[model samples]
Target: MSRIGGQLASRGCPHQVKGTTMTTQRETGTAAPHRVLILGAGYAGMAAVIQLAARTKGCEDMQVTLVNPQERFTERLRLHISATGQQVAEMNIPELLEGTDARFVRGWVTAVDADAKIVRIDDNRVLHYDTLVYGLGSVADTVTVPGVEEHAYTLNTAQDAEVLAERLARLDRGTVVVGGSGLTGVESAAEIAERYPGLNVVLLGRQEPGAAMSPKPKAYLQAALTRLGVQVRSGIEVVKVLPDSVELAGGESVAADVVLWTSGTRVSPLAAAAGLTVDEHGRIVTDATLRSVSHPDVYAVGDAAAIRQGFGVMHGTCQGGMPTGVHAAVSIVRALDGGQPKPFRFGYYHTPVSLGRHDAVVQFTHPDDSPRRVYLTGRVAARYKETVTASPWPTYGRMKKMPASGRYQRETYVGPWLPEPILTVGDTADDITNAESVSTAMLVVLETLSPLERAVFVLKEVFDFSHAEIAQAVERSETAVRQAAHRAREHVRARRPRFTADRSRQRDVTERFLAAATGGDINTLMELLSPDVTLWTDGGGKVRQALRPVVGAQTVAAWFAAIGKVTYQGVEPADMNAELVEINGGPGMVFSGLERIIATVTFDFDADGRITTIHNIANPDKLQAIAGGITRDVGTI
Candidate 1:
């Protein structure tokens, strides 16, 4: 009776699952963003959003919108945890994109009018995009075998794993036939067997588990599975899946309480339906630069893209998928700048497979993904795999801001906000002294003036340029530049105190500020701050930094105390969360929360090591390297 009836009729009517949306269509009003619509929030799609959002933070012309069936970021890499009834972190997509100019459309993408550059979302809304990033990633192949879609389970999403987990929990003693011997199947079988020792887990596939790895690592992986009480069945095929059993090739039947299908991967059929060129597997056919060959405006990435490199067509691994996302973003930006999108080059560095939480085997590979003789095993490899699983989100955050921190030009004495500390210098560039000049409280105070006023002041006071040069640099007439410069100079001199701290005192005050902020000791902070000292906090609206400057020492000290209040319940307050960094050209303090930079606390010291002013920069863009940078201290703050 409704728009979803026909599709439900076609699939024989599977009820609405918690995390998936029906492929339904609708129309809606024109969106405000220039609309760079990304269809999937998987590895590649997420890369595109973060890269574009950070690159075009305040730009009015571009809007990055991501469409997914669920609000949570599916840690598909750790779905085995879900299969065993374990809870994983619920990473909210909308919360991640909060401070940026990106929107999250929570719905399954139903249709794409490629010719018109429009997308339909779940029979409710329509979105139009200037450019489309097609990364509606892959899922397990259920159509190849009979009854699998109706009877077996999948680890495709958080909800999918939940369905399997509930069923697994109900079974006190039963054989769980895992009908694939691939990495996902291997991990799932090992997890289930280890957790439910009362049940049997048969890993069935056409090739031996870890068949792609070298002899040593392959043996190590198989042995770990054996130790977990998993039965490995290779050189076998699953012909059918029943409610309580699986039918294999050669008419052999294995009693199965549960079956997990993780065989061949299948992409969504939307590409072919939209008239875009697709490979035999239905993945979007992409050029060297990861753009769609049939429709140049569409960039394909992640598991949904059939991208060919010098090695071969890249398989769907997060290691390779993430690079495709980044490269697509880089190419898109290049095209926007009237430049060419270059080729995407990647290599297989490592293949890490977890046997469970306690054990793993890592296969180091060559550029072509062939297994090298070298490998890692046991706890060392387990920790390495955990690190790999956790690295991507923060790494993408780092890659967002190019020409940042150590690469930009010197900043001026602006009004209230902190100046960008320093542009990184090269071996052939000027010494640290020139870069150090940009980190003073004087430069940060200059940030308070209006854009025009600040530009005129910097080009005149700091650079010592004539009014004529300042006019040209600031794109104003010499008369206007001279007038603006006079007002800026007068305002700065009035606001600035007639004081300069000695080098020794400045260093002492800076260290104390770091110690106080990290320790969250408001009493110590108040002791060092002058009664008239001011504090400015910038969250860029992404984080919870103060909305406005907190004037006076008591107010500023209270703010510092509130920051240290985040004990996260059971977690330790100080465990590599705070560090002393050389921000711009001076000693500064940086704090991190949830693997991302939360804020930067910088100080301007007076003659006797008393704090005169403090700047807190929590803007995601400004704290790009807050978590990890080349400029870290040897020990904690």
Candidate 2:
């Protein structure tokens, strides 16, 4: 086991794996595998799948099966982008599950059996689950209004988005009506207006756009909509959807060539049918642990589960949904290990709304999602929004191996510990965001500061916190907090590294260096590397690698040169797909041989873009995850 894995074992991490006697197929006189059947491959369901699969990797007794309607992962967060004719990355579910024993079944779920624990898929297929995860996420509530089910378009799926995309593409000049003034509606309206400048876009809803946000962010969002040529009509109800327009409750009709509905959500009725205790809205009513109150065997997640907190029942969101999934997976593992499950707790942090590809407004929030005074607007906020909106899919990729360790601050309770921070891959000036407005290089440098100083700087500078709020988090006086923030700012300003070399130039150098190293060209490697460059390899106890850092350009270059001359395990250099990729917001490369993924290399550069640090990851388990992790973004539920 690796050091991290060892820590997991010692700390009693729920994912301790052990082999079992059961096989994959029907065996004579053999016991059946412990089947974990997960329904709906959304953000929550996908999280459960990866957590359960990785935890149960190589265990013969445990079988994790994920059932989704489609094989391709849905980017629910960016359906607006998809609807605008943008091409998002194609993430295949089965390809992601490769090498793991987890099975991906493509079929629509028709029914569920609470007593017998059998799930009927497509009315023709049946699956018996030792444990069932109910995550049939919600769709837009289209049945409430007249003619909406037939007349309105929704960004509920990629297919739905594509339908809208084709419709919009066909319309040369017409008005687009976005029903609802929620974040989704606002975003959709802004995107449509921005994409098709000729099309008149109108946002109609019961409340103002960004109604939930504080006054500042709310105003910014409204202004942004106006800037994008989106007409705002608030406090108006849509009584009916017509063929080419919508009729309002006030007997007013708005001409629209296309109508996109992003109103209230309605979850699947499978849980209610199966005798699970459900809320009035058809969401499964869950206890503190996320298990169904009526059916203890069924754990519900995502929008399907009406999970209650001190504040209220949780709404369907990617942020809260993912944690519930991870918690459920951990709880299930604990249950299997003869331990009681812990209660699930989550807190909302930020609401990022994109006002098109170029601009956005991000509203910071309290645990209850009521907006805080702070918010981000314009291009920087847009980038931050993009990072978060795109982060989930890749975060799922990382979770396939290492269950991200949750670190708690010594300070009192704040926001919930999440899966992982969304760190973008590939370096550039564009990479710096999160209203931290700090560059990756500066962020990296900030990590070296004392915890209090770091917190103060981030809260004051990045989050626009008042001195009083800073004092509360750090348990210090306002004056002390301000002084600490000042000291931290001075420290960072003195040592902040600046990069003038553009990404393209750096990418060229990195790619060429990778080419030279793969081809065993020692001279090229030496020329590219800094004189005092160091090579760090993290084998993670699964493979043999240098335990100590190898320093000096000549020594590091010569070592790689010798290794490249002779391929290991009957694999030639030609078999290695030495492809350039982005890793942790910097350019990186992956070496995949025929038999397995040989290694992954992440680099750090000096201001001039010369190679400084190379993080060559060759861990057996991690290498496999990296193969599929490089691609994909966006998710559902």
Candidate 3:
């Protein structure tokens, strides 16, 4: 018997219908494990392998196998350094797979039969898989321009880099032309010019280097390139590449002894050849969960997949690629557990570009990949780039040690803290005492306070606790408690307004606001909203949401207008039901679809009855408390 078969025999090998792995055992009377074949073993592929192996460590019913052309892990982020003959740390795939449920196979994948769910290795070895992860990654486009494939060198792989390094080492004096002025081209040109001072280095591309960055960082990058004795020629196209030179748009030939092409990328044709749906770029078109739209059993990640987001289809980068792999693994596990996978949402954070060994530039960005004003340059940026480039291996190691539940446990009573709602009798006389303490506006101010200050303030002001008692309750010194209490009191007094809309007027405005937002009427929404309106979406960092407060009437109106046009949580726009209800002793809105509360939107108003602040809580964990609609008599706390 095989090793897994022997183990299954000792355990009686009972059939299970809840898991995808035991499907083979159910169909046949024999024990067979579900095989997962991962292709490429790049940064993204390795993340999937490690996460899946660690998550299913002791499961004899599931088997994972990784196939790649080499046993060494290629650090694509450091490829430019390696291309310059610099040393980088070597990581072995099989060694990393040791002590896990996954095994590594060193071979090139010749073909993939998606219909048969089988893979053909270069040596004619066939492997059957219940699931396949396509992360073969992309290589520099050698087929685009003439003579590029036959004459130019590329940093596509370690071996390719070594070959280029050997050629550069032999040349003592010659012009080295680096094609494409993207980050790769800039880094290559800078590295060559720094390493071979006697050789002339020229960077040629259509767009200037760091053109996407803000003005300051872009200027810094350009100045650094100039200081390195490198010539940069932008706004020109390379029509053809020759062995001795490259032909520009105007029939200008740039003399070169060595040409490193870093222009464009091309994905493997295996996905399209296997009959999987591919986009214009020949990358697998995946659903929101990173699964192939045609074949849900196949998950695609990294440069091999074209994934769409709210902003747009994601570009290939390690920052976004690794998350795709991790999300694929999580989704696969959820499917095996007889549950549907949630949608995947990602936003770009920063872009780090290396100029050379000792210089670099980092541009901070918003979630939509737009450049932020903040940036770093010089050695500080270089160190930052090196740190992030070297982080993937260690991150994988940490993922292996973390429990699956621990990695995704946002529901365990942990999130941005909020005060509990207070229930009041519905039709009673409006004679409640100290009502500001329980008002929605006051709660908004409390949210701005530090956790400790908020706790102390609530205990002392609302509950009538003395300094000693408040200190005991919050586990703080009396002096500290007094200070926090003073600060909180002063902040709330300065910020909180003594005005609120009655329930009837509030409900009218809420109904209008909901209608305008759901109807995509940006003009009406802007009219109803305050000029300085701020929208706060609390997703608990568990779902796609704004990383910062969305401010301004125009921006907030546009955001909601877009939300009105799309389906959410499998609920169609026509099927969604938005109802106005009383929440936290104030009028609010509850969005329901598919018989569950999809989200809750509460508001805080100013004296003029205009909506000043909007709070949208969409975290599933928080929504569970009100899954069943509000009480007919009153809204429960």
Give a tens-digit lDDT track for model 1, residues 226-307: 9999999899988989998888889999998788899888999999888899999999999988888999989999999999
Best by lDDT: 3
In candidate 3, which residue pairs get closer than 3 Å at backbone N, Cα or C atoms, i.e. clash? none
Ranking of candidates on TM-score, top first: 2, 3, 1
Residues 155-264 of candidate 3 have per-residue lDDT tens digits of 98998899999999999898999999998899899988888889999999999998999887888889889999999999989999898999998898899999999999
Which candidate has the highest TM-score of all?
Answer: 2
Q: Model 2, which residues run further than 4 Å from truth?
A: 1-30, 405-487, 491-637
TM-score of 2: 0.67
**TM-score, per-candidate, Cα-based:** 0.62, 0.67, 0.64
lDDT of each: 0.73, 0.76, 0.78
In candidate 3 the C-alpha lDDT for residue 201 amounts to: 94
